[model samples]
Target: MKKIGLAWQIFIGLVLGIAVGAIFFGSPQVATYLQPIGDIFLNLIKMIVVPIVISSIIVAVAGVGDIKQLGKIGGKTILYFEIITTLAIIVGLVAANLFQPGAGIEMDKLNKTDINSYVDTAENQESHSMVDTFVNIVPTNPIAAIAEGDMLAIIFFALVFGLGISAIGEKGKPVLAFFQGTADAMFYVTNQIMKFAPFGVFALIGVTVSKFGIESLIPLGKLVFSVYGTMLFFIIVVLGSVAKLVGFNIFTLIKTLKEELILAYSTASSETVLPKIMEKMENLGVPKHIASFVIPTGYSFNLDGSTLYQALAAVFIAQMYGIEMSIADQVSLMLVLMVTSKGIAGVPGVSFVVLLATLGTVGIPVEGLAFIAGIDRILDMARTAVNVVGNSLAAIVIAKWEGKFQRNSKPKSQTTEILNVN
Candidate 1:
């Protein structure tokens, strides 16, 4: 018999994990045992991420052959990211106003999950002005930036280094060849790492379910459902429309990204799928430079799902406290979120961090975060999946816009549109 595909392996793992966790609910020991497996898997992915991103960016930029075109692509990618993210914030705000999930919430009925950790994190995080943000993108020490996994700084350094190499023409061939080999090695490593994904998904989901259980979802069901529903709407209507305008079906892109989405959703970490997404985008005819540059940058600037959650969470907290924000106040809140949400793309639990910062500024109680802390992981799963999809589509759309998308005549996608012949 033919073996099952990776997507199905992960889907099965997800299902079994949920079943096992439900069976073993209220058993902290089970979660404790399974948690390490997931942690190991995550560490393996984290170990390779910085190197893969660095190598890919350098190779992609060196291969671009024209620094002016590279800059043009960079500018267009940022513009696209900004437009899409702004739309996400607006959609999220609109959903929060229309649904008012927290309107009838009773403070006494809510579970008070300790949010001290998040609050402390928020306090320790220094808010950067726009000028400071721009300045921080240039690393003083590129090696230190890589050590800290500062993606923006690393990208900046790689772009300049790649351009310098390209400028030297024949003399730069060896440098270009070295990075090309590095990119190939990292892609192969990414493939090997992905083989462990199903097991990781199983462990992660099992632990998550066993620890949190369905009980934690009860008190804040409205808020959880609202966030999920809003995200689904944004993905289908907003992202789908954008894909249609770009002359491709969104479902086609989704089909291609099935495995990556499953991994991202189960892990609630989009970074896990970055290298794989870049590889797959190349398969779908996005040029390597565009995919590498756009996807990494999108993680920072094009955080549609996170920005949407921030807008909704801010409004949800205000409603929970019976605080009414005027139109002008909400507009101001959106403006704050727009600025505050950048520079936090791939950080763990970033949505909460962004929300914590935005809430205090908008006069909402930061402590309200405790109410939804229990359900954040569940919501995070959806958003992470959406983020992967958003980035994937961004690469495709930008490639098509640049007249670089190479369409297959067969039009076959990984998850759908396959044909069989006798």
Candidate 2:
């Protein structure tokens, strides 16, 4: 008998999880049993992320062997990230306004979770200015950055280290080979770890459903609907237009990333799919250098989905409290979001952190977030998928802009055969 593909296996796991979770809804035992499986899978993914990022970036930059070329790519990458993410914020704001998701809601009836943790995080985040964010990107100690999983600082160190290797001519060959080997080995390890994704997806979804039964979504369904619908609109209309201009079909790209999209949505974590995304982009004909540099940097700077949700959620919280925000007020909120949303993607509960930090400035109640915190996971899953799509597309756009995209090329062969689930 032919074996099942990974995507099908993951889908099966998702369906099974939902069914089991519904049956066991509100059972504490679900988390007690399933959380460990999910945590292990997540830990496995995290374990590989730092090494893959560092090695892949170092090899990519050194391979470019020209600071000018690297600079050009970096500039174009950041510019594209800024434009796309700004458009995402605008799209989100428009969606929230048009949908009126927060209207007609009785706040007292909804289950409000305590948001003090996110608020505390937001308070800390507010102390750091954009100038400080830029300054902190240059790691005072690269090892600490890696140990703490500080992506921006790690990326900075890798870029400079890679450049140093390139500058040394023949002497750099040994170092380059070492990183190239490391990148290759990490990809192999990623493939191996991916074999556990079905179990991870199953356990993670099971825990979510059990903890927050599907019925809990009814009270806040409008907000959930608005967020999901708006993300679809942004991806299909905004990012689709972008794909066309860059000479690729958005639908085709989606088809190409079906597995990654499903996995991202199921887990609600983009980091889980980071390694696969980079590998697949290279297979899709983006040069390794551009894919490596653009995708990881995009994680820090190009969070399209998170920015969109932050804008919509800020407006959402204001509306929830019956507070009126005029065009000027919303535009101000957008401006604040544009500044505060940057460099906080690594923070836990990042969407809430952004909203907490921005809402007070725009006259939205910081407490309003508590009203929707119960269903934030449902909203987060959708946005996480969009973030993955947006970042993947960024790699293609940068490659195209540099006149290096190879549309007609075939994907590289995998070193190991993917496991077949029977």
Candidate 3:
């Protein structure tokens, strides 16, 4: 008998999870039984992320070995990320205005969750200036940054270290070889870990569904619907246009990344698929250097999904509170979101933190977040999928811009390797 594909296995897990969750809706037993399985799976993914990022980036940059070329690629990558993410913000704002998801909702009827933790996080995040953020990206201790899983600092150190290796000429060969070996080994481990993804998806979704239940969604249905619908719009219309301009089909890209997208959505954490996305993008003809550098950096700087949700959620809270936002007020909200949304992707409750930081500036009550906190996970899952897609596409766009994209250029061996993993 032919083996089942990973995507189909994951889909089966998702469907089964929903069924079980619906059957045991609101049962604490679901959490007791399933949360550990899910946590273990997530922890396994986390274990490999930093190493994969560091090694892959070091190898990619060192392979290029030309500061001028690296700079050009970096510049083009950031520019593309900024343009696309800004478009995401604009699309979100426009969708919120048109949909008015929160308008006329009876606030008292909505279930509220404690948002004090996110508020505190927002306050701390707000205390830092842009200068501080950039400064912090240069690690005082690279080892400590890696220990803390500080992605920006780690990226900075890796880039410099890789360049150092390249600068030393033939002496760098040993170090580069070590990182290349580490990257390959970690990818092998990633494939092994992915074998457990269906179980992870089932447990994670089971917990979420049991906790929230289908009924919990009914009260905030409009907000949830609007968020999902707007994200779909952004992915298709905004990201699609970008893909077309770059001489690729968006649907094909999505199909190529279906497994990653599903895992991201189910887990509601893009980190789960980072290694796989980098691997797949390289297979799809994005150079290893471009894919490695752009995808990880995009995690921090180019969060198209999170930024869009922040824009939409900020206005959403304002609407829920019946606050009249003038055109200038909305524009200010947009600007604040554009600034505040950066460098906060991996933070727990990040969307809420961003909204808390942003809402106060626009006169939206921070407490308004309590109204939507209950449904945030449902919203988060969709956004995470979009983020994975956006970042994967970023690597491709940068590769194309650098005149390096080789369409359908995946070697037969690599194709076989991916199939074997699946």
Candidate 4:
């Protein structure tokens, strides 16, 4: 018998999980017994993320012989990230205005979760200024940065360390070689961990469905639908156009990333798929230097889906409470989101934290968050998948622009094989 493909395994797991959860809705055993499979899978991924990121960034940066080219790629990547992300926020705002998803919604009728946790996080965020954010990027203790998994600090340290290696010329070879090996080993670890994805997806989806059930989404169905619909539109219309310009079919790219996308959606965490996406991008012919740098950096800067959802959700909350936001106020919300959303990219429950922070600044009640907290996981699933896709495409587009893209004629065959050691 032919073995099932990984994507199919995950898909089946997803379907089965939902079916099982629905069959045993409100059963404590579903979460009490079955949830740990998913937790273990997430922890395993988290355990390796810092190392994979540090090694990959250092190796990619050190491999860049031309410092000017490195600067060019960085500049162009950031520009692309900003432009696309801004457009995403605008599209989301426009959709909210048109759909008015929260119009006619009664705040009292909806179930409100305890939002004090999110509020506390947001309050803490308020005290930290943007200048502090930039300065903190240069870690006081690189070791502490890695131990804490501060991505911005780790990225900064890796870039400086890599550049120092590059500056020493021949002496840098040994350092570069070490990171290259570390990155390879981490990629291998990622693959080994991915082999358990089907079980993880099954457990994660099962617990989510069993606990929340399909009914939880009905009260806020309009908001849920609006968020999903806008994300679909963004991916198909906006990111699709970019793919067309880059000389590839967006559908093809999606097909190539089906496993990562499904895993991301089921897990509701893009970090689960980051290492795999980076590997897949390299397999799709994005250079390691570009894929490594662009994917990680894009996670921080190019959160198109998150920003869009934030815009839509912010408006939805306003409409729910009969609060009116002026055009200037909405634009101001976007500007604040553009800043607050950056460094908090891969943090768990990040959207809530960001929304909490920005909601009050624009006069939307912080308590308004409780309205959607129940459905946040459902919304998060969509955004996480889109984020993985967006970051992958960012790397490919930047690679194509830099004349570094080498489209594999045998992607199916190439992706399953181990990366070339030489």
TM-score for each of the candidates: 0.95, 0.96, 0.96, 0.94
Write down the lDDT of every candidate, Cα atoms only.
0.85, 0.88, 0.87, 0.86
Model 4 TM-score, all chains together: 0.94
Per-residue lDDT tens digits for candidate 3, residues 333-357, read: 8888877888877789788888888
Judged by whole-model lDDT over C-alpha atoms, candidate 2 comes out at 0.88
lDDT of 1 by residue, 1-422 (tens): 99999999999999999988889998988778888989988999988888888877776776666878987898889889889999999999999999999898888887778876666656644365556767989999999999988889989999998777767776877777777777777778889988999999999999889888998888888888999999989988999999999998988888989999999999999989998888888888887788888998888888888899889988999999999999999999999888888886656689988888778887888888888888899999989988999999999989988999987522222211111100
List model 4 lDDT by residue over 150-233, tens digit each. 888888888888778777776667667777778778888999998999999999999999989999999999998999999999
- Least accurate stretch of 10 residues (summed lDDT) in model 2? 413-422
| Best-matching candidate per lDDT | 2
Q: Please report, as a residue range, the 10-residue window in candidate 3 with the lowest summed lDDT.
A: 413-422
Range of the 10 consecutive residues with the lowest summed lDDT in candidate 1 = 413-422
What value of lDDT does candidate 4 attain over all alpha carbons? 0.86
Local lDDT at 16 for model 2: 95
Identify the runs in model 1 with alpha carbons over 4 angstroms from their true place: 124-126, 409-422
